[model samples]
Target: MNVYAKNILRFVVIVFLQVLILNRITLHWFPEPAGALFIPAIYPLFILLLPFETPVWVLLLSGFTLGVTIDSFMTTAGMHACATIFMAYLRTNVLNALMPRNLSEYINQQPSIKTMGWMPFLVYSGFLLLIHHLVFFSVESWSAASIGSLLLKIAASFVTSMAFILVYILLFTRQNVARA
Candidate 1:
């Protein structure tokens, strides 16, 4: 199977999950107001899974398209698009910083638990997720608001999104653990 075809399929599946499943999860499920304070974001997993050698222009375009698609469904204006584009832009820098200096064999491969090892993959995902959340909430809160509440929302959502992302990576990203 072609890699791009598989990635497109993943893109569809993730968008569907976000729009149909995760988006409907109410805040009332958690403690009284905590639920209202947090909304897990897992859609960024698609962008995070892109090939390591994908070009900057491609990344930005893909991110924008994905974000716009989600925003259309959620009717959240263009906040998703903005955050997603920013996340995509930062992905390369994060990859360079975390990956080993030797890049001979790693080019064009997806960063997965199996491919990059657990720690590197975790750190990479964490850093990107943080940037995504920060940009997302900052855009969402770009209005008259309370600083404490905004921070609380960002913090709560960031934690939930991270936990959800890690679980998703563990379950979905092909892990090629080797036995000694």
Candidate 2:
């Protein structure tokens, strides 16, 4: 399938999975005071999978759209949108730092474990997930929750989200698909 068609499919699938399935999950390891640890989010996987050559404007718009879609369902105000846009804004810089010196080679490709290799792709995904979670949890806990709570939320959410994203890529993404 073409990149556009493939990304469209990914967009729908990731959103649905996130809203219908993942959003309902609330992991808790601590007692009453510390209640739910975090919510595992996989929606950002869509933003991360956009074509490497996608422009910054498109990235920001798409990220906002995706986040808003999730927000409408998840009822988190604009938290998701804000976090997603922040991550989208930093995507190019993160990619450039993680990628090899030869830019032309990866221009038309998607950032994936296959194309970028395991280590670089892992680092790229980790960085984005951390940033995304930091923004998300930080905003959610802004005034109401304590700094410790915010840090715990960020840590838990990041690990859970990263786990889901890695598994999704390993199991579903066409790792061996032709690269640019």
How much lDDT does each candidate structure score? 0.83, 0.85
| Clash pairs detected, candidate 2 | none
| Backbone N/Cα/C clashes per model | 0, 0
lDDT of 2 by residue, 95-120 (tens): 88888664446666888877888899
Q: Could you give candidate 1's per-residue lDDT for residues 1-180 as a string of tens digits?
A: 698999999999989988898888744334655345455789999999998888889999999999999999989989999999999999988888888764445766788877788889888888888888888888887864566666667777877888878877768855446753
TM-score of each: 0.89, 0.91
Q: Judging by lDDT against the true structure, name the best candidate.
A: 2
Q: CA lDDT of 11 in candidate 2? A: 94
